[model samples]
Target: MPILVEVSKGLLTQEGEREVFPKIAAALLEAHGLTGNSFMTPNVIGHVSVKPESECFVGGKSQSLAVVEVTVPAITFPNGQVAQKFIGEVTDIIDTYKAKPHPRERTYVVVKHAVDGPWGIGGKAYSNADLGAAIQKAAMA
Candidate 1:
């Protein structure tokens, strides 16, 4: 799984720049009820990038914006409600990290589901069932 948090330069405070990645990653794990799980916790990978405002645009105009793209297994986000909550939480996380005067409307979040066959790790493609087994195995450790 991969989570990308991209923001226009100056969108986040200096401290936020250093901290938001882990915070957003934790939010994702919590949303999936896998927070602190030995297996899942180690698997949630993320990246945070700051882009120059001159290179960032919305509707053809330069804008300071935040975009969060999280990719997960197909079995995740089982329903609209779950997806909605996660989206809102991602926005809130951004709001918490935003520099003053950064508009909440500029925050964007997207959750993409990768079909099970391609969810590979350690040279092995992991299906949904394999993930479940892995999680269970870790829990028993």
Candidate 2:
């Protein structure tokens, strides 16, 4: 799982910019009720890119923006209600990082699922069944 966060430079406080990555990861784990799952916790990772405001855009116009794109296994977000709730929670997490109040319209959250069989960890690819077994094994450890 990877949750990519891109923010317009200066949109978040210096401290917030430094810490948002792990915070977002923690929020994801919490949402799934697996905050301490050793395997899953280490697997949730991402990159935070802070672009110059001039490079950030909305509707093809340069603007301050905060975008969170979460890419995970297909089994995640099992239903619409679960997906919507997690999206809202992620939006709220990002909102707290803003240096100044930002328009909610500028914050975007997207979740995409891996098509199975191509999601990789280390050098090996994992199908949905493989991932489920790995997680279950980790939980029992």
Candidate 3:
């Protein structure tokens, strides 16, 4: 799983920016009921990109927006309920730390699932089953 967080520059406090990834990971793992899974630990990987408000845009016009985009293998979410909850939690994380008074609509959360056999890690292509097995193996170690 990879989470990409993009926020308009200065929209979040320095501390908030530093805390975003862990916040997202915690919410995601809890939502998926994998909070304590050894292989699905809180050490989830993510990245944050902050750009000037002038450099970020909505509808072709620059705007103060906070976007959290999560990409995971198709099997990760497993169902609409889990996916929906995850997206909501993601939005909540951004909403909590974003500059005060930012419009609710300006906070966006998206989840994209890579098709089986295309998601890769450690230089190897992994189908959903392969990834599941790998995770299981890691948990047992």
Candidate 4:
């Protein structure tokens, strides 16, 4: 999984940025029923990018907004409904951390699916089966 969190400067406190990603990562694992799967832990990566409000746009106008984007393999979510639920949950998490409360419309969350073989780590590529086997092995240990 790859998580990208982009926020207007001052939209989130420094402490909030520090707290959000780990919480989001954990929520993702829980959503997938993969909590405590060590193989998955190392694969959950995230980054936070903050830009001045003038540099962030909404409707072609600059605004203070936070955007959370996650990219995972298509198999990660069983269906569109599940993906919607995940998006709602992520929005709530951001709501809790935002410096100023914003409507759901202001906090944008996007989920993108990467076709399996194109997702890579280090210099190697991993298929869904390879990832599943790694997670299972880690869970058993």
- Model 1 gets an lDDT of 0.85
| Model 4 whole-model lDDT (C-alpha atoms) | 0.84
lDDT of 1 at 46: 77
Mark the regions of model 2 whose C-alpha exceeds 4 Å error after superposition.
Answer: none
Candidate 3 residues lying further than 4 Å off, grouped into runs, are 138-141
Each candidate's TM vs. the true structure? 0.92, 0.93, 0.86, 0.91
Question: Where does candidate 1 have its weakest 10-residue lDDT segment?
Answer: 113-122
After the best TM-score superposition of candidate 4, give how far the Cα of residue 95 lies from its true spot, in angstroms: 0.8
Clashing pairs in 1: none
Kindly indicate the candidate among 1 and 2 with the higher TM-score: 2
The Cα RMSD of model 1 versus the native structure comes to 1.4
- Minimum summed lDDT over a 10-residue window in model 3 is located at 35-44
Our tally of clashes for model 1 stands at: 0
Model 1 misses residue 98 by how many Å?
Answer: 1.2
User: What digit string (tens of lDDT, one per residue) describes model 1 on residues 47-113?
Assistant: 8999999989988999898999999888888889888888888888788878867787889998988
Give the alpha carbon lDDT tens digit for every residue of 8-51 in model 3. 99888788799888999888878766667776673367899999
Candidate 4 regions off by >4 Å?
A: none
